[model samples]
Target: MINGDFNGDGNLDIVVANEDDGYLAILLGNGNGTFTGPFYSAPIFSYQISIYAADFNADNVLDLAIASSDTYTLVISLGSGNGNFEDPTFLSPENYYSANFAIGNFDTDTIL
Candidate 1:
């Protein structure tokens, strides 16, 4: 599970990795300690082990970074600033299986 203000709504939201179902579940918050989702699903295949959130494109909207151990792919799903995500951008890394990642401006150039 990953938590962030993905919708730019000022409330914390949750995105859960569901490997068995091959999708991610989004739970949007109501700011009153109540949540209102599992509203959308982002489809993916194989076993997903890790998920992270950040504004990968510098759009100020939180996007998802998913690592799939079984599929050996890194997926970047850009957010729409309204609790929705676009279709993922897929990447194949040589040693992706069972892999994990950290998101940051690694080069200090303000890019993630």
Candidate 2:
């Protein structure tokens, strides 16, 4: 589950992982006591554990970091700002950590 305001626009988006077909659901914020989403017409993601969103590149724009502990893999997605996102330009495949990683800036702008 991705409970984050990745856009930095102040509306939290929730992305629920459908483990059946490996798809991600992006629930948009209505900004008025309601959230309307699950805007998935097709399937996305393939076997994932947990999804985290943050500024992984220090670009001030929030991005997504998806972890697959079952596969010992950690994947990341860079935000596109138009309600969609993409993967990182540079990947750290060697860093195969668990999906449910605890992330917070410990004074170095890092999400680990």
Candidate 3:
């Protein structure tokens, strides 16, 4: 699970990889120690899936990046900054069984 102000609403929110259900779910916080939603992403159909969050498109909205070992691919879910995300973009990494990945400016290009 990961937490951040995903909706730009100044409230903490959560995103979790639901391996059992094959989806990524989000829980939006209400700022009063309560949360709502299990807003789900598309089914990943993988047994082992991991997730990370960031503004991958430089749009200042937090997005999600998921790695699925069963599918041997990384999926990107660009956020709409309103607690919702766009469709995923899949990429094939050199390591087919990559269980996790790092998001950063590895090339010093100021991009993720």
Q: How many clashes would you count in candidate 3?
A: 0
* Residue 103 local lDDT, model 1: 80
* TM-score, every prediction: 0.91, 0.69, 0.90
Cα lDDT of model 2 by residue, 1-112, tens digit: 8677644568877777676776677887777868876665244446777777777767666677766655566667777665667743424366556656767877874544
Provide the lowest-lDDT 10-residue window in model 1.
92-101
- Candidate 2: TM-score? 0.69
Give the alpha carbon lDDT tens digit for every residue of 3-26 in model 1: 999888899999988888778888
Clash pairs of candidate 3?
Answer: none
Report lDDT (CA) for all predictions.
Answer: 0.85, 0.66, 0.84
Best by lDDT: 1
- Residue range 28-49, candidate 3, lDDT tens digits: 9999999998788788656646
Residue 61 shift from truth in candidate 2, angstroms: 1.9
Highest TM-score: which candidate?
A: 1
User: Residue 14 in candidate 3 has what lDDT?
Assistant: 96
lDDT assessment of candidate 2: 0.66
Residue range with the least summed lDDT across 10 consecutive positions in model 2:
87-96
